[model samples]
Target: MKLKQLILFCILIHIVSFTNALLRRCFQCRSRGELGSCKDPFRFNATEVEDEHGLATTPCASGWCGKVIEGGGTYSADDFDMAIQRMCVQRGPDDNEDRCAYTVYNSRKVFMCFCQGDLCNAGSSFTASKSMFVILTSLLYLYSRWNQY
Candidate 1:
């Protein structure tokens, strides 16, 4: 009947809207000029506040989940410092995408990455880049060897 069809359509719409309302999540933590899981070579240990994989996450209802790394100071000396922050960022329109941006101010260097989807702001992106670098380097080495013959 028409009534049944209308009700079914309304139910479907409600389900889709509900799914869309579900917010994305990302690791939420911070560390400043000190050593911790939130710092370089980030390795978060298992804790009750973290997920099963030991990642501390928070809901990102607006904008995108973001990870920020800031470091500065003389690398050859003991004054080197670093900071890291992971959280939901609500900024301009461009903050809604999956991209990494780097900026430098004075002696400080900052690297910030924004990403959509649940838990997409994790450190996997760094690992992926490293893997790609290895693959590309190997390919270039092989190409040079082949052309040498």
Candidate 2:
């Protein structure tokens, strides 16, 4: 009976771990000075961004990825200032559900986009190591469960 209970507990733990692995992950980066991969015409590579830039991806509890462009020019202007930011945005229930939006904040022109995809804030894709870990852990637990039977 204890063995059966143990198996059930292991299965529950695996389910919870795997669910956490499904959280939306976004490339957490920002433009610096006049050079950065996070700027317009964003360029992203899983290894390069993680290794060369030394930036880590962030998991969003809200399941939303966001890209923010802030500048001093008008929305119609061709020239602007400041930096771009890629981050996880927590959206409230009453907030706008639109994919993109334009607004003015503190006299700065801000263009924001919210997406429901992993790594959607950047035009790139990456594999989650946590998911792989969960898979391996579950397999190990199953192996032990069977060996006892």
Candidate 3:
């Protein structure tokens, strides 16, 4: 490839590699366990903590993890427990028209979402932070042009 093309390709590769979503085995926990009280938040597997802490949520295999917090009770009625659940999530394949239905709002006050970045679903939004991406790309462009001659 020509010098310009080669430089562009290198920059693209750098951005793509760094910006690519990270894969991770995140810590999964929830206020309501599969069983009952005495569940440990730090217990990620059977080997870690006692079963009394309920059970460790399944690890994220589809490339996402998340936390759901809902109020007004499970029924969305007044005066009830607010449920908080955190665990792995799969947004769905990109081949589909909608890569991910990140959020779904039902008639109840329930809200759900998913993320792609590693541990991004840890009670935060699904999308990865991009502020640095813009600045870095701009800088790369300037640097490449200056060194072109």
Candidate 4:
């Protein structure tokens, strides 16, 4: 019946939407200037880099994008090095999440910030909204599928 077909179609659409959101991964990179969009030759395998900085790849499943800053001071000495890390965050800017905690060690204040879009944490300002991109892409995909049938 048409009712059964409609239910199945609705389920299929939901599955596609959920899958797209889950698969939306952020690029793992450190930047001195500003982080670019996670396009190009990079694909999401979620690989961690082995280094003293202890940076890791992150997925934006929970909520927003995050940036971790360590050693926000002078870098004149040979041992002085600044590290910037980007990851998928679970909470927003005002949320009291575990990952958003700030701690200081050895006169270094470890700071964190959150943004609500893909690659939006590249800098202080968000270039584009990830949700917009997702909605647009999804619409196009659904439109193409409709045309096919």
Query: Which predicted model would earn the best TM-score?
Result: 2
Where is model 4 poorest over a 10-residue stretch in terms of lDDT?
A: 36-45
Query: Higher TM-score: candidate 2 or 3?
Result: 2
> Which digits, one per residue and each the tens of the lDDT, describe model 1 over residues 47-134?
4445443247777777377788776545634313567777787652453446778865336678887776555565655432354457
Steric clash pairs (candidate 3):
39-53, 40-53, 115-126
Task: Choose 1 or 4, whichever is better by TM-score.
Answer: 1
lDDT of 2 by residue, 1-149 (tens): 67866876787788767655665777788774366667767766445665647355887887777787776354634433667888887772246453677866448768878775556677543334445567668867876787787
Candidate 3 ranges with C-alpha deviation above 4 Å: 21-27, 32-59, 74-80, 90-110, 123-126, 129-132, 135-145
Candidate 4 lDDT, tens digit per residue, 28-146?
Answer: 66644233323222222333333324334456775477666675455545322545666775556555332445766348687776555444554523234455467657766875676
Query: Global lDDT for candidate 3?
Result: 0.51
Greater lDDT among 1 and 2 belongs to: 2
Tell me the TM-score of each prediction against the true structure: 0.52, 0.56, 0.46, 0.41
Of 1 and 3, which scores higher on lDDT?
1
- Which regions of candidate 4 deviate over 4 angstroms? 1-24, 30-58, 74-79, 95-108, 124-126, 130-149
For each predicted model, how many residue pairs clash, with residues at least 3 apart or on different chains? Answer: 0, 0, 3, 0
The parts of candidate 1 lying over 4 Å away from their true place are 1-19, 32-34, 40-48, 51-55, 72-80, 92-96, 104-109, 125-149
